[model samples]
Target: MATLDGNLVSADDLLPLALTNLGHFTSMRVDADGSIRGLALHMERLVKDCKAVWGADLDTGRIREYVRQGLDGQSAPCVVRVTVYDPKVDMGHPADADEPHVMVSVRGAGAMPPQPLRAMSIPYERDLPEVKHVGLFGVLHARRAAQLAGFDDALFVGRDGHVSEGGTWNVGFVDESGTVVWPQAPVLPGVTMALLQQHAEHRIATVTVEQAKGMTAAFATNTSIGVRVITAIDETELPDDHPVLSQLRETYLSIPGETL
Candidate 1:
């Protein structure tokens, strides 16, 4: 079951519409005790995106209440998605300012798959890379092509061959000096990446496809999979486990979660 603005609604009600077609959302895992990491950052993301996408202010305090309502007393770990959209907005004039409501949905959380990913580089990029918008056809299309090509997923490469991010995750590399290097390209600043950056010393650098192969280690970060080391990029093989990677995982795990 999903809660749309404090009211229980069928999941079917989340279909695309001309007005509600545009959406800003965040996905995170809630522990068995209902604690979450970087809770304030998640709320800040919603507030900022809501202002940019809808030109309306969002009450994050009430939004938290709605999220709790969606959890509905469940004590087990679950994946939570919080989406903000306006189903009743006028579609004829999408530019007009309108209020958007929150949609909180919960589901059973799955453990991250253990296998390292064999990624293939694809020339593509996301529009409005800063916002976590619901426009994902580009990513899905690229992912499908990669799977068909015998790759686990697609790593987006700019026209200049600079590595950016994965279809649904943020990509980072560790240098020989144990520095966390983020690709200095246009990409979505994900919640998990934000959490890691806040607690770790990282640098932003422009990484070419060839330069990535020379890095000591590479990893992908997303809400669904907290962190996973990349095994290979295109044809260059990378280590699945390294001392730096283990330290990165430890750093991420050490960040205390907030009580939801």
Candidate 2:
């Protein structure tokens, strides 16, 4: 299901987004009971990105209503993506656009793959590493190149050789001592990563690709896939089922979710 400002979306309403593609969005997994993990962080991210991209203030209450309307009283867990854009905005004159509108799209929830992912590190960086904007050409291109090269996903490493993040998720490492280590780099502050940081004993540091390979274990975190093991980076193989990493995944999922 899809909704624009709490109403069923029409093709005409999406022309601007399709044409100009100037927007920011946030996706969250909504449980059967209409609750979400890190719900506040998701909402906060939307508001922050909205302001950063369009200099507009978004009403979180209205966003929640639009999302609820998109859910349409469904009783199954699903993935809900709330996109902020202005249909009135045209590619030629985006600066004159009005306040952004909320587009809520719903789909069936997804789970982590049964097998651990193998990622290849690529030297890439997003336009605005902090905001989760809609500019995904580079991200998708990198992922495609990695897949063609016989890899599951792409892990972004900066030109300076510091590992930043994954294609659509935050990458974290488990040291030999069982401590979680997050790379200190310019990347999107993922809600799932934030939640994990609150509950897991972790530290942040600048981690290069070489250093990451030496780590005992690694994992990826995102809203859809709460925590997924990363078994290999480039040609270096790591443990797929570290006990600490497994415990971290269980801990993240066991946390209570909040109502939309």
Candidate 3:
């Protein structure tokens, strides 16, 4: 994917659309097993979001057809992304209007990283806090900072001093009581997190950074990475032999054809 005017551009004509102006959008990944995964849920949310922001008659059927045609002949185990921008206005409105624009791209699958990742805290905020969008400068910045700090990614600390999420994944933590907690704010509704919620015998809560320290184990979830255990956070390291993370890793690997 290419960047034009700070937005992800797959074709020249899509350059002018503001992906964030729409009420709802989705960023989904199609794995090698030919599974669409959370595409339906993403689309459902997109409709609700688009309706809230742009009003009715957003024509989601048009968007779905666009995705189907765009990905008709792609290989298995590839990554696909579709963005719906401002659908309520044309060129006259602000650049961030919600006229929807669909974009698609694919990349070859790669092996997963073995070592557990570490994360550091950083600042971020979601404008809508409901639907996904194409603006990711904060994620890019956090990833760069994580690389410089010798880690895989960064955990966003929202203005309310709560743990929001990782650059591209939803955050999870196993508290000292052996309970799992996932905060609802400052995070996108992740498909992988939904899967984990279904699979794990755990609980969920709107957690805080101070409460995060009481966690004995931490991890993140995304379609690409599945479930990734967090070994360290800001110099606080969990034991390599921690059983909770080990079990989560094992459960993750048990999924058929889920390898990175």
Best by TM-score: 2
Q: How do these models rank on TM-score, best leading?
A: 2, 1, 3
Worst 10 residues of 2 by lDDT: 107-116
Better of 2 and 3 by TM-score: 2
Q: Residue by residue across 24-71, what tens digits does model 1's lDDT show?
A: 898878876678888888889999989888889999889889988888
Q: Model 2: per-residue lDDT, tens digit, 1-260?
A: 68899888999999889888799999998876778999999999999998898998999999988887888776567889999998999788888886899999988876543368899999999999999988899999999999999999999999889999999999999998999999999999999999999999999999999999999999999988889999999999999878988888888988899986
What is the lDDT for 65 in model 2?
84
CA lDDT of each candidate? 0.85, 0.91, 0.65
1 or 2, greater by TM-score: 2
How would you encode candidate 3's per-residue C-alpha lDDT over 188-210 as one tens digit per residue?
78876776676677776777766
Positional deviation of residue 174's Cα in model 2 after best superposition, in angstroms: 0.6
Provide TM-scores for the models.
0.93, 0.97, 0.77
How many backbone collisions does model 3 have? 14
